[model samples]
Target: MLWRPFGINETIPTTIGALTVLVAGIVPWMDVLNIFDIIRGASLTILSTIMMSIVLESIVFFGGLL
Candidate 1:
């Protein structure tokens, strides 16, 4: 979404959405390998989930704010 259309704002909600999805995967892996504690992983998961929710809200509320 950032560069695909050439001028899409990289700082927009889509960025947060994509970043959270990536974190969802990376955090779990970090936890499984003992790089992150259970608490850290769980918190990160929650944060990512919340960010995803916010993306939906932004889409509905702003309606293609780009």
Candidate 2:
């Protein structure tokens, strides 16, 4: 019960195999790792800095300080 492209007699199994391995690898580590553990914190810190800088720049720009 495999739906394959026309003219190809053998079903393509490589794609299925690769996806299976990828999911299996990630499923085990999901609990031990999370975005807030590293990435989310860093990203939020960076975003806050950028936003503050923009606000400061706007004040300076409007005030003719720079």
Clashes of each: 0, 0
Candidate 2: deviation at residue 14, Å? 22
- What is candidate 1's lDDT per residue for 1-66, written digit by digit as tens? 424565666677677885787687854654555744647878899999899889988779646557
lDDT of 1 at 66: 75
Model 2 regions more than 4 Å off: 1-33, 61-66
Clashes of 1: 0
Clashing pairs in 1: none
- Runs of candidate 1 with Cα error greater than 4 angstroms are 1-36, 61-66
> On residues 4-42, what C-alpha lDDT tens digit does candidate 2 reach at each position?
667554535676765676688854555446634768778
The TM-score values for the models, in the order shown, are 0.35, 0.40
Error of 1 at 33 (Å): 16
* Candidate topping TM-score: 2
- Give the Å error, residue 35, model 1: 12
